[model samples]
Target: MEYLVLALKGGCMGVADIIPGVSGGTMAFITGIYDQLIDAVRSFDFEFIKKLFKLDLIGAFEGPHLRFLLPLLFGLVLAMVSVANLMHYLLGTHPVEVWALFFGLIAASIIVVGRRIGEASVSNVLIGIAGAVFSYLLVGMIPVTTPDQLWFVFLCATISICAMILPGISGAFILLLLGKYEYITGALRNPADPGNAAILLAFVGGCIVGVSLFSRVLHYFLERHHSATVSLLTGFMAGAMRKVWPWKEVLDTVTIRGKVHVLSEANVLPPAYDSSFMLALALAGAGFSGVIFLEWLSSANRG
Candidate 1:
């Protein structure tokens, strides 16, 4: 039952990860597994690797918390394999509805994280503001041309994996900015393609390297400065709402590798007080309610 619960949590993380402005780490935090997930990733250090190489399977598995990791990983992989293409289709087809849902999710997440601060101090407030402004500006940047080479893919994956694990920051958004989101997801959805195998290998290698190193640093800071870190992460999620906002006015389009994509967009008020706008509002409400339900379930489990 416990493993099943953890796997379900992982599925939630995977769903969040598939969206551009949503983070799996944010879902993990909301679902009460953030610290455990970070610790599990952090366990793959020098000593653990040594044990694995020496064929000390028991030591390796026990040391790294694989009992916890295996089910979570299984769920994550299952969701990725089953839903990646569905997410792509949804993003391409029902974008407004999808963004509306995630917008509500992130908004609720901000509130949830903010409450963790217990009592907000001026210092933490300033830190939170700084985080919000930085994230807002970062997400608004236009993408420039980047190399499609395998080495570049590895580097992007490394950076993206770091972002993926951080609360409030979305690694998929980072990949979108770097122009590699579609490139990598395409390979993931079709690994049997001739060249995609190499791409997936390099990408996974970089993810391993990034997660192993970044998780340690994150775990250290989180242990020492829990309140401040949560405050900043809250701000990050708050600011990220700009990207997830359901209504946007596209200013221009650009061609990337023969594909036309939005070059720039500005958040806009819904054009009219009409049925479409009202439906979007309802969807947002549904998303917000979903988060509240999840919170209730989390608390009930704890009790």
Candidate 2:
């Protein structure tokens, strides 16, 4: 039962990770496991290596907080492996409703994160606004391709992995911006594709380098300036809500290398008697309420 619950949470976290403008870290935060997650990741350091060499398997694992990490990472990996396909199917078949639920989840997430700021100081407020505007503009920009060179792949891995840890940024979206989303997704879908294995390996290598470097910075910020940083992250998430709005019109469908892709212009449903619109609203409301309920449950657990 415990494993099942963790897996379901992992599934939701994976769904968030796959989506643009959403963060698995944010999901971790709302689910009451963010600190534990961070500690576990931080535990994989030189001390752990020393313990490993000493043939102290229990000590090594405990040193790295494996008790917390093993289950959590199992959940996360399981979710990533499974949820993406499920989400892709749902998005393709019921784009509006799926997006509506996502919209609601983010909406409530913003509220939950916002309440963490104890006061509305000028600096914090400005930081929040800056975060919002920056994210809002970022999501609006057009994507460009990066040369698929080894160094460039490494660079993309570093940057995208850092974004993955941040609350509002999507690592996959970063790949999209770098023009590697389809490439990586293709490799995942068809591991045997020529050159795909190399590309995937490079990307993963980049992520490892990036995460190791950035986690320290994140730890510093969290320890030194906790509330301010959280406020800024909350603001970024709030701004990102624009990108995840449920309704969009397909502006164009283009074929690149024989694969068809849909490009959309974001839109809002007309305030009228359209059944689709009604359904979207209902889904959005459900999504919002669901997040709120999750927040309440998380708070109760903490208390």
**Tens digits of per-residue lDDT for model 2 on 192-242?**
676877877887788767776787788888888888988888878877877
Model 2 ranges off by over 4 Å: 1-4, 49-60, 149-151, 191-198, 250-254, 261-264
TM-score of each: 0.96, 0.88
The lDDT of each candidate is: 0.85, 0.76
Can you list the residue pairs that collide in candidate 2?
none
- Across residues 1-303, which tens digit of lDDT does each residue of candidate 1 receive? 989988898888887777778899888878888889998898788988898999998887777788899999888867876789999899888888889888888888887778887658998898899889988987888876678899999999999998888777899889988989888888879888879999989998999998989888888778898888888888888878888999989999998678888889999988998998888888888888888788878789889
Off by over 4 Å in 1: none
Colliding pairs, model 1: none
**Model 2 TM-score (2 dp):** 0.88
Error of 2 at 225 (Å): 1.0
